[model samples]
Target: MSIPALDAQGVRGPAPAAAPRATTPRRSRPAHAPGRVKVWQRWVSPLAALAVWQIASTTGLLPQSLLASPSTIAVTAAGLISDGTLPAAIAVSLQRVAAGFLLGGITGILLALAAGLSRAGENAVDPLMQMLRALPFFGLIPLFILWFGIGETPKVALVALAVSFPLYLNTFAGIRGVDGKLAELARTLKLGRAALVRHIVLPGALPQTLVGLRQSLGVAWLALIVAEQVNADAGLGFMINDAREFLRTDVIVVGLLVYSALGLLTDALVRLMERRALTWRRGFLGE
Candidate 1:
């Protein structure tokens, strides 16, 4: 047997070899991780519902007068599209919505800025706004008709009124909710009033403002539907009203679907804006 090596102090044996590390098996990621879900999965429920509806209609369980079959509605929609009627109505509705949105958006932002920036403005503006918000806006249709008449003005004004409150409330809350420490830091850095507002306040309030925008858009469409009932000669509301006179349930359904589609499109646009604008924000939903 070989003798163990020793030093001047007479230590006996070589250091024991280091133990080998145990390897752990890696875990496979969950299929349901954020953004990992397939796009088709989202449509499954809606498609299934639609299929059930079609089957029910085909089996005569669902009456056409109550709600037309999906196939009938689809055919009617195609006919409307082939002619210029649907396109013209859509254009008119789009114009009205655009005008109302612009008018209301500007008014809301200005009011929010005024109230948020000054105690005097808040005292002067907020009470009136609060009182107005308390009242059902639809109740003002008669007053609006008296003031602006049964023309497009009243319709647009009603939509504007509906759109304004949400934005104003949200923007005001967002401005007030901004971190005071950030404002203090801004002051510490000697930021001017304009610079502070432009750089800090507006950017800080944007997320809430976008949320308000989505709410306002939904309200706007609802308002448009009600407003158009008051003597609209052109637009989806007019088409629906005309269809009601002739008992054309499919046309009415198509009009309602168009309204829903518009609302969804607008909401989707606001969501996209939120994603782009709030890239820096990380909430419970991981990117």
Candidate 2:
């Protein structure tokens, strides 16, 4: 027998097939969904590391002399800061890095442009750059000390040398890698050399040039540390060397932390500059 329906006010009939089911399972959020992480997500691992370090230090698992606790490092750093040593050292190192990087970067760009555009320039300069790039920056330290007499000049020169080759190579590669059809079109259009280079070449090569600049900046920062460590009268590296001599592990720890922080800051700035410079390079594979 068919089921009977009551009036609208007192309906007692089977529900319609189209009736919404309140109990239906809603879609679950993805485990690896983008933007799911907090803005401060990167701090989690570092905070965990600090906690573990604090625990290890409290338990004496790590010798005080060998691995100073975070508190000790902080105290030492504050003392250094209060005495103006840390700031002075940082300033000196940064000045050296800036000078060297600017000099080397300009030379690299000019060399790369010449090589990319001229066969003679490439034949003359590329071999020398490749050889120089292959040589270790540390290996030149002694030579630089000898030639430049272990002064600020030598340190700056060494850092500059360390930074130049990568920029040169990447820039040259970028220029060479530009679309051949575009070049041919420019030629067919009777574009002047200056116009072609300014409008076509520079834009085409900019993305890779930015990559090179980022890479070179990292190298420059590393080289600056090494350079500062070499009989330096004043710098973070010198502080580290001095701390080692005095067996002040806390001081040593402070120097290292400062170095790491400075490196991170510089690298971050370079990355920001890269993002700004290469805004036209969005959505590429492996970006």
Candidate 3:
């Protein structure tokens, strides 16, 4: 018997329709790397610029006497390294910066905390701090030399000045910016002063404090450079100054390079510390 065509009325169908094929699974593209190109790009521009400078100096487009080539600078730096003078200078400069930055940053934070927490403290201290901040740090250089006499004392004092204001301002701002509601809640709960600060205030203030710390570190380094260069001293800054006097532009360039590299390294260290200290701050920019 032959099969009849299927219809609405009813008849035998040829066969059931085959099930539709499923679509091929989509393949995901690989994830793009974060901050990769930025790393290379930052270096590329500087290297290219240095190459152009080297070419200009080599071709006499810039006079050798006025602008030293990279190779000459490298050689001069190598000589200093071999003789150990550069290393010693760097060590001394770093020591002064460390001592002063620690002392100043700590004191500033304490004072700022006091001023921010108590109206009486603010009234007594903030005015003097403002005045002190307004005075150019370098202006005190002469007095420091007079009192401390061209020793490490002057260098340390200068760095301290540089470090203090940033820390104080930032700490004060952070403390004051703490949420009033939290304070009220703490009071309602009958939390002790220490408990209130430890739980509520410090965590809230940490991000701003880190920012101030980074800024203070930069200022400290800058101050160290200037302080180390002045009067009867040895440092990267002094090396640069001395090189300029003799027109050893190569050595001067080397000194400058060292200063730049050291600044970058220290900044990187601070960022690493920040990342570790503020684990909760991840996924948020500027935290």
Candidate 4:
């Protein structure tokens, strides 16, 4: 028996060949799409600059007397490392930096807290702070030398002075910028002063405080460098000066690069801290 074709019936019309199902187009991702990390892209500029620098130095397009090549700097750094001089200097410099940073940071945060939280405190502390901040930190070098001598005290003091102002300003601003609504809410909730500060004040101020920390750290480095350069028995700056006296451009470049690397490293550390601290923050990371 032969089956009858459905097309013969106008009601069915062979079901119209099931009509081709429409397909969704595959989408091309945007360049900045999250989770797409192009790690190599980050190095392109630095590597290109290095290539240009190497070429310039080797081909005599740039004078070596002025600019040392990366390779030469690397070799010089290795020599310094072998002699243990660089490590010793690094340790001393880092010690001074740490001491200064701690002193400055503590002083700044405390003052900021006192002033930001109370009008009386502000009246007492803010004027002196503002006045001192107006004075160039480097200019204090001569006075510090006279008072503290060319010892570690002056260097540490300078670094502390340098670190304090940024922290103080940022912390004060951050605390003051906390939403008044939150304060009122805390009052409404009958929260104690301590509780209000713990829950509402500090957390809210963290973003700006971190920014201040970064600035303060940069200042600490700057102050250390300037102080060490001015009069130092030992430090990275001392090495640079010694290298300068001997016309060891390579060594000078090495010390300079080391300083740059330290700055970058410290900045990176703060950035890492920021990421961890602000994980609750909503932004491009979607966190």
Best-first order by TM-score: 2, 1, 4, 3
> Which 10 consecutive positions of candidate 4 have the poorest summed lDDT?
1-10
lDDT of 2 by residue, 1-287 (tens): 01112232123222332134424534222222222354367679999999999889889997787888888888888988999999998898889999999989989999999899889989998998888778887889888888999779988898788778879989999999889899899999999999889878888998788888878888888888888877898887888889888778889888877777877787777667766666665456225
Per-residue lDDT, model 3, residue 178, is: 93
Give all candidates' CA lDDT scores. 0.84, 0.80, 0.80, 0.86
User: What lDDT is reached at residue 119 by model 3?
Assistant: 97
Cα deviation of 60, candidate 4, in Å = 5.5
Query: In candidate 4, residue 133 scores what lDDT?
Result: 98
Off by over 4 Å in 3: 1-45, 283-287
**Cα distance off (Å), candidate 2, residue 245:** 1.4
lDDT of 4 by residue, 165-235 (tens): 99999999999999999999999999999999999998888889899999999888999999989988799
TM-score, one value per model: 0.82, 0.82, 0.81, 0.81
Residues 1-287, candidate 3: write the lDDT tens digits. Answer: 01111231132121121112122222111112223454577798899999999899888897767878988888878999999989987887788889999989998999888898799999987999999999989878889999899878888888988898999999889988999999999999999999998998888788788889989998998888888778646777777788778888888778877888888888878777878888775656333
- Candidate 2 weakest ten by summed lDDT: 1-10
Candidate 3's displacement at residue 43, Å, is 6.0
Q: What is the C-alpha local distance difference test score of candidate 2? A: 0.80
Mind giving the per-residue lDDT tens digits that candidate 1 earns over 99-205? Answer: 88889988997899899878998998899899999989999999999999877899899899999999999998888888899999999999999999998999999
